[model samples]
Target: MNRLSVSRLFHLNNRKLFQALIARYSVDTGSKDYIDGLVKDDNVVVFMKGTADQPRCGFSNAVVQILNFHGVNKFSFHNVLEDESLRQGIKDYSNWPTIPQVFIGGEFIGGCDVMLEMHKNGELIEELNKVGIRSVLLDRIEEEEKK
Candidate 1:
């Protein structure tokens, strides 16, 4: 075969091999109902790349920091890196193709960029307030205003 045809054949074979491997290793993710329950079960749920204490990605770390900055220490976090199914499942479930998804009061709250925007605009404070968890930044601002 010509060089171009040989390369094309090789690429096709590689693609087939990759597909077979994926099919063999694919895992069954939790059902949509299960994901719904999990997100709603907690006031704050974060589907990130790693644990809250040790985030695997910068985006995940930013999310953890954002939550901590607001004095939100007691929240639920699922490490997507540990579960391939969860990694894909959450993206599919939220219809948001990104890691480090944040949920508040059982509502889908977008990813790191959205969180940063909310934090800057003080919208995050209001959302937290709705769930009965006050933001510490609000108290700091109030204290400064009183002085």
Candidate 2:
């Protein structure tokens, strides 16, 4: 084959290779439009290892606890383990390899550890306030009592 033909062949094969990999976790997503909508609806969405009530991993559990500590009881959660496609797709969707990934108002906010550090330093509260999810009033009193 001429060099030009070889280049064209490689390009075609590359395209197919890309499609095959992407297809592996591609959801009909049509029937599940709720996935995208829910992620957007909540001011804080956590794609963690499990749900808020029964977090599976230590990291996920800690994250939920941290939010609860601030009196933020409600958050959207996607359990990656429950759905094979979601498990892989979310990693790709967030462009982040780790779980317990937090999303605040349609923005990716890294993982649990990142969140914990931010919380300790008061940045988490700042961010949450920016999004209008203020920590409950009792939370303020409780935190003050601890200090």
Candidate 3:
């Protein structure tokens, strides 16, 4: 082929390839925003289906209770159902496809079932120990019963 003809063909192919990549790699801005918020609020984060006081799902309620039982007095909660973007965004953020996902110190701790298992065997205490939040059930009861 002539040089001009070859250049035209190459340009056309390049444009098509660029368009295809653009179509395939569209960014989900809403989900990205939600995930950023979740990860940033990472000291103790629970991506549950509902609020802390009134958990909307059984699994979430169990998780809240478990954390409370362990005396994790303060924590942040994201209600995934309140925003559809958050529901999907948290899965991406934690790489764990489940609600009631707990994160400690910006790391993926585990889900509700995992938390329960760990709490049962005192494994959760070890994990919390690093952040200086060990289970202090008796201590809390003595000093702070209103929590």
Identify the leading candidate in terms of lDDT. Answer: 1
Off by over 4 Å in 3: 1-37, 137-147
**Model 1: lDDT to the true structure:** 0.91
Ranking by TM-score: 1, 2, 3
> Considering TM-score, which of the candidate structures 1 and 2 is the better prediction for this target?
1
User: Model 2 compared with the native: what TM-score?
Assistant: 0.70
Q: Note the residue pairs that clash in candidate 3.
A: none
Question: lDDT (CA) for every model shown?
Answer: 0.91, 0.80, 0.80
TM-score, cand. 3: 0.68
* TM-score, candidate number 1: 0.80
TM-score of each: 0.80, 0.70, 0.68
lDDT of 2 by residue, 63-86 (tens): 899888888888888888887667
lDDT of 1 by residue, 1-147 (tens): 999999999999999999999975563554586688879989999999889999999999999999999999999999989888788889889999999999999999989999999999999999999999999998899999999
Off by over 4 Å in 1: 1-28
